[model samples]
Target: MATITSAGAGSGIDLESVISASVAAKKTQLQQPITTKKTNTQITLTGVGQLKSAISTFNTTLAKLSTAGAFNKRAINITQDSDDPILKISSNTDASNGQYNVTVNKLATTSKVEGTFASSTSSLITEDGTLTITAGDGNEFTVDVKKGDTLQQIRKRINNASDNFGLTANIVNTSDGKAKLVIDSGVTGAGNDLKISGSTTELKMFEADTSSATPVTGSSMSRTQQSTNAEIDVDGNILTSDTNTFKDKVQGLDITVLRVSDKDSDGNLKSNKVDITTDKSAIKTLVQEFVSAYNTLIDKSTELGKRNTIVGGESQDDGGALAGDSMPRSIRTLMANTVMEPNSEMTGINSIFQLGIKMDNDGKLSVDTDKFDDALDDNYEQVVALFSGENGVAGKLQTSLKEYTKTGGLISQRQDQLNSDLRDLSSREATAADQLEKYEANLRAQYGSLDTLLAQMQSSASYLSLLSTS
Candidate 1:
């Protein structure tokens, strides 16, 4: 089609239109098939991706149902008898169903000791000495006192020590310019008491050691609080804890003693009753959600693989891209079979339907919430067993769906093959286009040469006829 000396000018023939029509016919013959294949490939890929996404979302919904915690969860209720709750309580899924009467007799304490000083800033350290403090859990820290160190300065040094164990030191200055060094231990329990000792006698006057017989001596130091364990009475059984929280006292229940229970007129410690039971409502809600998700997946698969509808004598609806594909059909059949099949191993409630998961005629799921709740009230364990074990409904569905949706899965591999075909078609189309360009150019060149030959022959015939006439 490039402008050459007009191909039919000398020969008086319209060769340009002929060449154009021939090239058009050749292009249709060579490239139309590739164009059709590429369009179909793109359509199928889009449909498959949408279907995979739907299956993945449904799988996520099944995750909660496959776990034992979803069914075995425990909710607790405690009687608030006193204005101040004696204990703060909670239970996990592992907690047994039972009732517990709990009473907090005595709570744990941390050691608090204070030392008196005649003046807030009086020089206490006459010579170089070391003040050492020790406790359980490898808590041993020392503060080196230099000469002419005041009581307030020593208190600041203890507070600022980087390696100082769990304790705080404060100088509480009295009204008459006298001061007191108060040290409160954060290390809890009786055996884990804080002990302080100084190398010199004058510094020893400020000593306070809970591990020793005389924890505080002289007029300088006094013990305000002693370290003790938390004690509680539960159903005639006494329990002790190093901290305020008494963990596992009621078999998977953590009871943190807030304060001692109020005493009655007869001096009997008031008690609160705790009830632990299976959380049926939460589990039932999870089952209902799973059914909803299951129905959604079925609906999506049907829409994706739907066939054309014929109204009267004409096709009124165009078929889906995946209308003839077995991938979507197989997925729907697998999930539907898994749902409809009754459990052979489980007794009484052998299937999801017994748990009120009803299937429609068109293969969709519906939840009867009341029936499911009633089943939970009567046969909760059987319902849990139907959905949680290795052969459970959710478990089997996940296993089956994994084949189609996992990395390099069946559908993914199919998509990969289709993309490979599309690339091949693209390469072929480019090569064919290049060859056709050359072909068209060659045809124009040959026809232009023929036109010049015909023009030369006409000139020769005209001269020959003139010679004959002469």
Candidate 2:
């Protein structure tokens, strides 16, 4: 209320108190309903937000269950008795459930050629010529050796060439006061072999010919190592690869040959068995996670629609902040329908119950572990179809939940409408506050004028009374 600077000072009447009380009464009448409506709107908005969050989380779990990798996973085991593993292996979900007898005969080797020199800094190449180098799949390029170039300088020139493919050149000390130009293929494999030919006889010593009848050893040159492919025998079927790592050898399998298995005294190859099987425990965990997420969403949604009895005999729905809203009821119906309905498109296991997932009396899911494990053991494909296909439980639930939780969807639209209402209410409240302020000012002005008139009248009455007494 606007205060009067000199209100009722001469009238002996407390008009300020009266005007303040009047303004207060009017303020309550104008503001109380708006306050109540805004409070209710905020509460409902919060409840709807929580429901949307729960549905979004539930949809994530549904996505996890719907993926092919989750249901079609396979586990692998290899014999651990061997000190050095013959090979390391991994498989995808598409891997077959079987055992493989793997015999690693030899690991792939990279081509390494060394060119010996009389001394590290001696100018060995007496002529200037181009050395054409071929590496890995006939990629031919050339490096020029300048006249009077030392072995170390020639090695540096080769190492710095950009077109050298995967060839590396180094000058290694052979411990006889002479350095050797060691050239190695960057990648391991016979296909990645490095070959060199020169235009001059002096540079011919740098040629890499590991398959010579006799070891190509000159006074200062030798072939230290030869390029070779990896060899493995799978149940009498020999498989060879240029690289150490082999992929798609078996469907969905990748094998990296770590080392060659030890041979017996009779030269018989040692073998190991790799067992691939369905991962039942992983499937169980995914199912449990889905159940837990579904239960939480259901419990929260149910609480939002429930009514509670007051402390005394009266009954009220004060417990549900979102009481009488259709969204909660719609959510419950959608989830229940999705779970109970049969997947007509699925041929074998068309319903969740076939996978040993059952809804209890409290509307929560419980899994029968024995039944689930048995289903996984016997009918794994059927179990997978029940939860993952087009008409699968997870697929249907994901589609349905997306309708409610996606942008511009039902829940999103409802929240957007509520936010709009809050914005409008804020504007209305501001306008009401301004109006009430102006109204209180008018009331104070009117009361202050009335008090001045009353005081003047009292002064006249007192003067008349004095005149009559005199």
Candidate 3:
């Protein structure tokens, strides 16, 4: 609607100001409640969002602790009487608790062959032919060397061969201007010995083939090392491996032999005793995390119900936004009550308190570490069943969270309802503004007509008085 620029200007009665004030007063009355409710709804939405996020996080933590494997974690320690452990060991969750005596008889070795050249820049291969190479476990490959190929060139071809076995070729230039081509097995094992055969006439000078374990002498090249497997005696049971690392030999145990155990003065073999036990520390950490997350949710949820004293002004209470709200209040109550009460199916130590998880007067959870440790030591399997079973603490908490955090659940429905309320308020606000504008325009028009008629009547009365006096 267009506002008249000179409203009441012809009569000079200042009717524009009066019309504006009247419209403002009516607008306040119509819009105040809508604005207040929208503000309160926004605050409530924010609070609900915080509460939902906290609960979801806490529920996730509970899920991790509620698993059977989480409680079954094991720790391994390898010890020797007076010397350092010769083997590095690790275990998985499926590993059982046991002590094993391991004696290392031998450690695996890689094979090496060294070929002395007159010079690294000197020609190594005089004829173009393929050089057959064999590595770990009798794996063989071939590299075609061109005629008049230098020491570096032949080494590159051997290193870059596509069908290359686990063999690496390196050229070491000596101080006397001579170079040596050293080929080493990339793996360590008994049958993984490096062998080279079938080269050109000129390349025969560097041939040192040990395919049949027979040493080739009277050549520029010589076999410097022999391939061997790692052998260890575990509790009188002999074990051999191509690599020093042994897997599943002791049932979920991985034994990586670093060195052979040193012998005592009496020439008796010193063995390492590996003791594997349940890792109670892991279970304790999980429980602590769950408690922390649960307390965070409880604190945030409780804040939604707290109210402060107010004296005739905007409520000083931070929770005034969510005051009288049922969803948040009920959620807080459910979480508190569920954790405190016992459920069916989880026998004996059904409640977390039985597991030494205690609650304070202020509704925060804390673990009595000594008591908790004792409970774990005495009733380990019972503790696992209490948290991971069908009617466990985590199971119950997850059920309650699913009701609110699930798709189209309580939180989602509340968000949708708040959005609808905002939309309705916007529509009402627009309608109210239009109505006020129209009301002001009608008032200005009626008052302007009155002012014009009053001025005409006064002018006529003045003229009559002037004529009668004359």
| Candidate 2 lDDT by residue in tens digits, 421-469 | 9998888888889989988888878888898799999999999999999
- TM-score of predicted model 1? 0.75
Candidate 1 structure quality by residue, lDDT tens digits, 126-180: 7988888776678888988889999878988888888987678898888887888
Ranking by TM-score: 2, 3, 1
**The best candidate in terms of lDDT:** 1
Give Cα-based local distance difference scores for all models: 0.82, 0.81, 0.78
lDDT of 2: 0.81
Tens digit of per-residue lDDT, candidate 3, span 318-396: 5544666787668867877988887566567767788788888777899998998999899887777666644667777
Cα RMSD for candidates in order: 5.6, 4.9, 4.7
Between candidates 1 and 3, the one scoring higher on lDDT is: 1
Q: By summed lDDT, which 10 consecutive residues of candidate 2 come out lowest?
A: 211-220
lDDT of 3: 0.78
Clashes of each: 0, 0, 2
